[model samples]
Target: MNVRHQIKDYIEAQPELKRSDMQELHGIILGIMPDCKLWFLDGRDESGKVVSNPNIGYGVQALKYADGKTREFYQIGMSANTTGISVYIMGIKDKKYLAEKYGKRIGQASVTGYCIKFRALRNIDVDILVDAMRYGVEKTRV
Candidate 1:
């Protein structure tokens, strides 16, 4: 199936509370980036071994590795975990920025370098989350 369909299926497969939360986040992120590219990663390698939770990604950025190789990846990504959800803001240079800038203001979430993780949507300040996401998208733009 298509990427959007895959993302929908993944969100729908969550538990009732998580399902609604995921759906809300999906909508909010789309509202922030209406025309951005969409992505779905099933959290497996080419060999199909599960390495992580499934992820739904939005926007795009070309990343350069330490070896000078580059690869295209999403600017913002979200995933479901056992305890809660994770929102990843890729391509930030400073590892402490998110935590220092948004950790306290973002309510109950864990604001890391590239990830904002929380147990539920109602537990966090989504406006600050939106600000963080917008910063990520704008910062990583080509």
Candidate 2:
């Protein structure tokens, strides 16, 4: 199916609580970036083994490699894991920025370099999350 369909199916396949949070998060991200690229990764390698949690991605960022090559990827991503939901704000170069800037204000969540993981949407500050994600988008503008 298409990217949007795949994203909907993935979010709808989660458990009730998770499904609800995922849907809300998806809508919020879309509102933040209304006219941007969308991606759905099944989290499998070419061999088709499950390498990671399947995720829905939004926006586009070009990643430059040390080898002088560049690849297009999502600027933000979200996934449902066994314990909670993970909202990934990719394309940040500094590994410590997220934690240092928003760790304390983001509510009850794990703020990593390029990821802000929380158990549920209600458990975190949505405004802070949006600020962090908006920062990522601006920082990765290309």
Highest-scoring model, lDDT = 1
> How well does candidate 2 score on lDDT at residue 17?
94
C-alpha TM-score for every candidate: 0.98, 0.97
Q: What is the Cα root-mean-square deviation between model 2 and the actual structure? A: 0.7
Please provide, for model 1 over 1-142, each residue's C-alpha lDDT reduced to its tens digit, 9 standing for 90 to 100.
9998999999999999999999999999999999999999999999999998999999999988999999999999999999999999999999999999999999999888899999999999999999999999999998
Clashes of 1: 0
Tell me the spans in candidate 1 whose CA falls farther than 4 Å from its real position.
Answer: none
Residue-by-residue lDDT tens digits, candidate 2, 22-123: 999899999999998999999999999999999999999999999999999999999998889999998899999999999999899999889999999999
True-structure lDDT of candidate 2: 0.94
Worst 10 residues of 1 by lDDT: 104-113
Cα shift from native, residue 64, model 1 (Å): 1.0
Q: Give candidate 2's TM-score.
A: 0.97
> Candidate 1 has what TM-score?
0.98
